[model samples]
Target: MESVVIFDSPGKGRGLKAAKEFWAGDVIFSEASIAAVVFDSLAERICHSCFRRQEKLQRCAQCKFAHYCDRTCQRAAWPEHKVECGAIKAYGKVPNENIRLVARVLWRLDKEGSMVSDMQLTTLDELEDHINDMQEHDLKELKVDVHNFLDYWPRTSKQHLIDDISHIFGVINCNGFSVSDQKGLQAVGVGLFPNLCLVNHDCWPNCTVILNHGNQSAVSTVFHSQQRIELRSLGKIAEGEELTVSYVDYLNLSEERRRLLKTQYYFDCTCEHCKNKTHDDVKMGGKEVDGVKPSDEQVKEATDYCFQMMDKMDKARLNGDYHEVSKICRDCIEKTEPILADTHIYLLRMWSTMSEVKAYLQNFEEAAEYARKMVDGYMKLYHPNNPALGMAAMRAGVTHWQAGLIEIGHGMICKAYAILMVTHGPTHPITKDLEAMRVQTEMELRMFKENEYVYYSMREAALKNKPMTMLHEPRSVEEGIKNLFHRK
Candidate 1:
């Protein structure tokens, strides 16, 4: 609580304010969900109680609604599940995640309990709810669902149903965060973290959220037999500055990011990153707009071209036509690169796809180049230590090694491993996989280094009488060896 405060952010409405300056990687705070519901589609793989990926799970004998890792988790989750179980059973089918989430929210406001103060139901009352903005059919569906959830058939009061239900659903819509694992690769569930929700949206956020769903405990804390969502500073934050996180993924052009924010959160973003025209630069698009900014015409042209290329890439990928995808991706890159800069969100995906395609095709040198670009793009767009950037770094390292740049590849792997270690911890699958890569890279680096000295010495001996070579003119064997050493 001392780390942050809540106040009017003017154009942004209520926003969380930093109480003091904080550095990158600093933990602002951590809290578990107040009322989280694992989406039905993912429930089979993700635990209902702790949200961990479970292999050996047992169903609640009575309700058969949730699968838990063991008796302990089942018992721990019983209190919350008891009423929800009955509600779903009464519904005669599995309630969709939205309905279940709203039900849980209503229950918490009415009866559900939590172990943490920040997660208390009272903190949620002041949250924003866009009842007046909702569509007619959506409002009607929510009303019916709320009525069913609250068992309104037996109630005498009917006047407040529409208003109350709409308000609650609105709150959830505005504040709920789609939960993902530490790496943000899998959709696990959704939750209303009242305090985290208080942090306003910014296209270029100064903070990041990571959900830790592990059996291991933090150094100063016990692994609460539940999932934990931790918010950390992405970079240094000054006192009184508003703390913000991106509501939508930042790997999109300005227009797409705005579209997503408007559609999902129902708000217009005017953050500095959004206000800036050139977030990423254009190479040949009308008068270098500096960074990623393009003129209106350039924006439209790049947007249209990107969409067209994306459609082709998607269709080719779905059809398992890797060669077509690779070809189209290269065309997209070449076509867009001169007009669109590396910072363009479209290029990010293009570079990522190219890296994967080349890697699959065993064109290691080309794959390494694309992977490096992917890492560079992510580093520019994402917060420090983002899992995506870390993964990209690992990808670059592996491909660079495959391309015979062992020492450079090892260095990249080490960098990626360090970032992953801090963000994802030692036990996460991605972290462990990166750890394995780091070890292999180190082994290769050692072997390569060991041979390099002797090989270079022999080459030097043989080339002592030979002339040095220019970039284009290899005068002797020494020139070729030098070129190889420099990766020319």
Candidate 2:
């Protein structure tokens, strides 16, 4: 039987369809790719100034990782090396080639580099040709712009940096890293796999890809004779639809998503949300009875007005004007609502913004409800493993706690912690925050229990002070105090 097959998904984009219908949660295909080109732990011992993994390291004065055998190597590599040194220190590790691929692509695109000098049609053709020649594994690796670096391998010493980058891509193209669980977060490596990449863009996605890391180099594959890993539909998808996954947090606005997609992938999207012509030309409190044609100038004015409103909303958020932010977000939504439906990513963001606004206004119950709805919708699209899902879960928990729903708060917090622990591992910053919240909640529960006991004890003492005594002898105040202290 064929391992995988590609075909058109009904009304969705092109998708990898199953050659044979498989059961739910089946592994469609699994390929491992290297997670990191350079390990952070190893880099610390080596000269961070250059890509030399060393021991007995001498640290660079400019950055923490710029360790050198002596001042000579440091000085020698400084001109080409110093630029990335501080970045490495800030990130605390060198990113692998895959990450570099995305970074390089973005950097070059932003700088208008010659790499993508060709027009969009030509670039698309080149990409399609490259995909046609690739094996399943190669195709998967090629999905991310970073994996494209694999095609530029076999570099000469004259282009050492170029060669290094190419090799990094090649390594990550074949290997997958194991994420480490420290504290509450996971450590991620640069190599994002190709199969995962082909999962197209959705404002909401069904499955979430997680990273795993450890200190060993091992690769293993498990195949089932009776069952296969299946890409179960998160929502209904007709035959031949493009199976998509959200690359960014779907909780973000359409503008944010569009900007990221254009900057990262060099595509001008005409997605359902972006092509809302009617909504884009509408105004607040202005009525069009559906028969009047808007003038070109009117359309331009509406477009410019939307942009202006977005700019103002951004400024209001940055300036800490929660009230203005709330009002502006509402205005944007009210204006856009008649044109854009609820499924638009911007609408989802508006809901999130509304939740934030309500929270800021001390309307915890309403805020919590709105956050819960957002989380529910996000979970449907991205599943529980995505970081955005975890964040929504965390926010939902916080809102519940604020609203005095202790049981619900605990449940949400626990769920968030569990999801974050797997995706980010135990050592990630977000995981640490979740861990702290969990501990704090548990402590609060304990304190509440203690306070209840104290209240009961004091009430009993007050009743006894009224000279009411049972047939049995009553305990003295000293004895009672001792007993209460010793109960635990």
Candidate 3:
């Protein structure tokens, strides 16, 4: 009973629509990737057999390219690994990610017509490759990649010529989804979810994909094991509402978003977000913004400074230097406080990063405070049900949980889960992890309070009935809170 209703649109070609009303925190559907390849950069870091991010990894004895946690993982991966191993041994290096994915697609098609569903919920033939729409340089680069991938085919599988390989390339260009970790931090792999690929892009999308549990072992995994593309309702969806997912980060400026959509997806987004200019852009038109705010030029200068500071903080954070990152972020905050909006992307990001740094260093009280600030910022910046909003709450919940404020952590996590279900789906790994923590925290609280369930039950009812809406018009904090309390 997965969500899979197709409808035609005047401009969007075949599009997915909700078959029934979906509550804000509901899962629309979940499916494993048909073709998946762990990126080379993530190979050593993540278990090749199970995709787990772990340090104690065992390399495949023969190929040396595959790393598993144990013999069990190595054995479970052997079936697929045998072929990939042979290909790598023949080539003397692991193939590029796109090449590997194409190989997986072709191999799966030859062995099993479709990877996820044999009934053909969707088809490669129906996918719009946008090959002609791609830039000339990209096309040429793809052609070379096709040739390289074609060499991996077994003698029997090579029956299809270069043209066939090109079609696979086109399909990938049209529908590939980067498989990121549970946190949506980094894309460690690429996967093709045939049924999920039916989703069309909306600049302000109603749904988002969350990766649920992926394989954790190299030795054994479930039959449909690579990765699951769990589609979650990002907001309350009425029956017949178009089910869409953003192909790019929602924070990208309007112009940048449209450009990426056009170049990559072969369509210009005309969604509401793209249709109306942003506050910054609108200010240029001489309209009065709703709140007391710094002049546009002043805001821009502060934002620019924050961006540069963020870049430095990011590099330091990546290299595991938390001390430097924390200082940079604090300076970033001090400078931005005067001119930038409270919900400025840079400001929110700075707070979120500092919270993470504190959490990493086990400064639970400080982490909780910073994370709570992030939650408020997210509430102002993103949609009511945005995954980022949920993630912010979850971060705060974890810090509270670590600080032994089980009651606070339990409530925050429960709230976070409700929002995450809308954004990451109920089954997403992130959602599941948070939910697990909530349960554990609740159990601990029960040992002390004994009547905690009553409170959460009432809170749950409130969250379920909260109306979904687009954010912002009140550029000031007062109106924002006034609007929130007034929401149905």
Candidate 4:
């Protein structure tokens, strides 16, 4: 907040602008969550205080709902949980993430007495709800949530009018940021950071938002660090330049991106890419095969088929049927590869899914191959310093290393490190891990080059008694799919 000033952005509403020049990787600002809650579905898995996922968590004995990693985390979350514990028990079930979030915000507002502080740029009342812009179906769903929220609200607590409650829900719908886990991989919750909401969207943005789960060794620090976020410059920005981050994934074709933005955020994108349909050709490129080129109509037909396949794939994924998801991806790729270019969005999606599923199934060589293809397409489609590109490259690099392609693994890890240094900064846990990986891969490459025979002999001997599943965990595959599909 100190590094940037809130100002009226042209075309866009209010935006955060740089107060001074910022070099690539410089942190523009960092803010802790005003109010946050883990998704109910993940309540048991993720610590309520630190937002870290664990295999075993200590359940709050009193509430019998909230979970934490240790007494330290439990103590840290008590302030937030204290208000809702009795209400949740009386209500007989934990409300969904949305209702719980709304409750958290209300309780916090009651305690704080004011929504905006002296240094705050906007008040909670000032944040747009876009309720009027919501479609009929969405409004109906919101109404249901409001009803549930009212039922879940405790009678002794301060009450709010239905209109005000509904407005808060709309505001959250329009402004909430997806909070990621400690590794900046899987999304675990949703949070509201007021200053972050002031930033505007751009197809080609100059800033990236990272959910920073702080140092874990220091329990007190981790407690204080829950749901914190840092906004970093994607590249150089001069004084007074507006800081923007993409609300939607910019790698999608311009039309699809705009459609998503308009549908979700209630804004028509008029960014340069949207205005000019820039990179649409490359996104939707098609090629001829066996002296037969797909006509426009054929490509359109294939694209439609791919969309249907994607829906099925999504359902299978959500159902936790990785085998079915892999089958769908392979079938779609076989049908669309000839008619659609390898760079097509649908093709890339399939390649990404195939890679993760293959990795999950322990087919490392095939996983590495598909991951490499997905990373190559991402390189062509995303900004050179895009965080997503860096993440994908890191995944590909790890898959390659697991598959025993040392030279290629070293190269990809180095590439990922360079990109992440710009997008995630060197201090981020993911970037730090990538740096460690790069060092390991580099050493392995040198060893392999010096004596390929000796290197293989030693490596084989070392791994002979080790479990085949030890190279990569299934969670990594889960993280890959979650990161690609979920927003943050």
Candidate 5:
């Protein structure tokens, strides 16, 4: 019996419904991408075949563009790359990920004739493109892509009509999934997963998608280097419950989420969260200080300023101007702290950016503070077991650990591991890394508690031998660890 069945969802075109009861952490379905491509920016740094990130990669001698880890990966990718390589050489340059992806899809379809799997209820042709619903700007961009695609398309490959190419681009814009690397830390590419696309969207989804890149042990037998995705149940789902996943980050304001859905997916969300403006007040709420609360007008003004600053900060970050980004975040945070509540999304954004930039600048102590605040805000905004919250906690734990706050760092790592166990499961690379961190932290904490003098002595001796400069000096060690040896 199948684990999931397809049915026409009300309002939604088609939806996947669970055929049997599934508890949290259960794998509902696993699928491989029918077509995929590495991002153009990472084309050289990441393995074109295995999608691994490395400082140095071996470039394909033929195309002089496609890269690989070694001969094994090059051979594995040859079936697809054989055609792509010829096109890149013929065209004289590589196209964007979207165009390249469309080309790969066309090549695959021409070869296999788009056969449906036993469990697949929909085909690539049937997927909605919403071409008519697209805005003029979006359509214009699509037109540009279609033109470029035609130029880059090989004359020898199977020819596709202009309408077919346009429709394929439309489908991808709405349905394509971000393919993460093996550790699931960052998206290295984009892929088309047919059945996974059938899962509808929800503000608070009961299922989360995991892009399984396959590990060394599994790669040899069950899983391959191909891009595969898994749908995991986030909580106990009934047999007949319709499986859903969030199309956008659920942390956004209701209005923002609705705008994104309408613009990108061509659908106006009427999800309960959107309809009821759930958590909107808290996410944008203003706080009172000294018995004086901020007025609605003041709150709006402050939020507007924060939004403008965040826009600039994002651009600065993209430009690699960390100092400018840090300054903008600091200014926005200071200006809005009094008016906005601690959990306000705007403040959280600043904290998140500040944490990242500070960490990059090696201000570990300050970065850890901002990361802790970010995690605290996330804890309130996200579901108790949300994977995002777990990732944030994991990052905060690492920051704290880097700053030598072992007690708190150990606790945060344990918290992340517990949440990831449910969201990502134990076998995921990220979860495995967190588990190792948890163990190592626990051991260090035990050692420090056993004898802080000896622990500090060993650390000092190691540091003295290396003679490194400290970028961040902790203001004070936590009371728990500080008092262990001082109390006499």
Candidate 6:
């Protein structure tokens, strides 16, 4: 429990504070989840083409396992299934629910395995042990639904599937469960781990964790890294403070947010925002009116004003209002800055937006500077291979090119292209954009060199035709050309 209490961040209804002082840029925690799934077992029982389970189904010729109802469903699913078929066949047995859940969690960890480490796996093992010690009622309740779900399936010729699946459930019972009729909600994927999950919730969390689709894997990636994988403070934490993170989007209304956190995370938030709405209401009132206490309508107006301002900022660039875009973006930064720290995602967006606007306004130098900051912010929030980071790198490269720094521009663009190629692949629109920019930059550099050569030749001709003067500024045509070329 003490290990889980890594930070003290007080706000909204819950706070996340540092259990120990963490240096900047450390990977506080990382867990993997499943990114993709092939419900082959489910497919075996359903139409592969329509993804609708049925008692009888026909198998596709390409991969004999893909059961389809008709040619239409088969044709529709061909694009997605073609590539996945080989991999699915290779996986051999469909993993048991527990193994499947674990695999799913692992898949959620980004495709890049940079944040993963041996220590995280050990922590997962510890969680398994802890769950095993739960009350008998809890264990029974958790497993009953899962066992029943398996019962519905026709008995497979392979008994190993049932045995393997049962073994997985045994592991899950040791952890925890939320059961429904069709499936048992295992604790492994529910965002719980004594040390990792102990970190409290915040409306404005300093860090974020993305659970891969299907809840197979999770990675708690810092939006910023000042240090390596050491536990650090989100803000300031007292010795005994309970560290929290905003499990849901804090930008939503407090009531809605509280309900989500409670329902999903099982914590009743008493964070500052929920506790002191009066103070927040008053502060909001001050934004709209002089010092007068705002009426309910006035409060709503003020809230709407801030929300609309943010919305306007979001669309300003699309609408082609550069000046308003910049102004509104900056205004948002100013207003949100106090409530949301620099590491907040919203703040990072504001910084990036400002950088983009600067670039569009032809302030290349400033744009480049802001672009660097945006890159840093993105790197902190996302893994190195994230498309957003690649996009930011491309923007920075463009700014460098605009400022007449050819080498740096080329390097930045090349880096952007490389990363984009990996994350989104060559055919992605962004990858194509970066590739086009690279070509354009190369062409401009070649033309610039050619222009330099032409200018030098003209200068040489002028020097050669000049007559001798008292100042000793005279030369033959050949000498003049040589001198001008030499000077260049």
In terms of TM-score, the best-performing candidate is 4
**lDDT (Cα, 0-100) at 302 in candidate 3:** 81
Give the TM-score comparing model 6 with the true structure, all chains together.
0.34
CA RMSD for every model? Answer: 11.2, 17.3, 9.2, 3.1, 7.8, 19.4
TM-scores, one per candidate: 0.76, 0.42, 0.80, 0.91, 0.90, 0.34
Q: Higher lDDT: candidate 2 or 4?
A: 4
Ranking by lDDT, best first? 4, 5, 3, 1, 2, 6
Candidate 4 lDDT, 30-136, residue by residue in tens = 77777888887798899988888799999999779899899888887788899889999999988888888889988988888555355466778888889999999
Q: Candidate 2, residues 128-155: lDDT per residue as tens digits?
A: 1222334576545445434333333212
Clash counts for all predictions: 8, 45, 5, 0, 0, 69
Q: List clashing residue pairs in candidate 4.
A: none
RMSD in Å for model 1: 11.2
Q: By TM-score, is 2 or 3 better?
A: 3
Question: Could you tell me which residue pairs clash in candidate 5?
Answer: none
lDDT of 6 at 321: 87
lDDT tens digits, residues 1-488, model 6? Answer: 22333333444332334445432222345332211223423546655332333577778775476676666556655654554454345554343434434333333332324234444422333222333444577557546645653443323312334444444344443322211111111111122232343455556444433221121112322221111112233333444445444445433346766776554444467766766542233223332224444356644544555567768886766688889988987777666544443334445556766776776676777667666666665554443543345556776787777666666777788877876664444543345667888998787667656796764455357547962111111111111111100000
On the 0 to 100 scale, the lDDT of residue 209 in model 2 is 45
* Worst ten in a row by lDDT for model 6: 479-488
- Where model 2 places Cα greater than 4 Å from the true spot, the runs are 1-206, 213-244, 247-309, 320-347, 357-366, 376-390, 410-488
* Superposition error at 70 for model 1 (Å): 3.7
Candidate 4 regions exceeding 4 Å error are: 115-119, 219-227, 288-294, 315-328, 468-488
Worst 10 residues of 3 by lDDT: 479-488
lDDT of 5 by residue, 390-450 (tens): 7788888988877778899899999989888887778788888888889989998998899
Q: Which wins on TM-score, candidate 1 or candidate 5?
A: 5
Candidate 2, residue 397: Cα displacement in angstroms equals 2.0
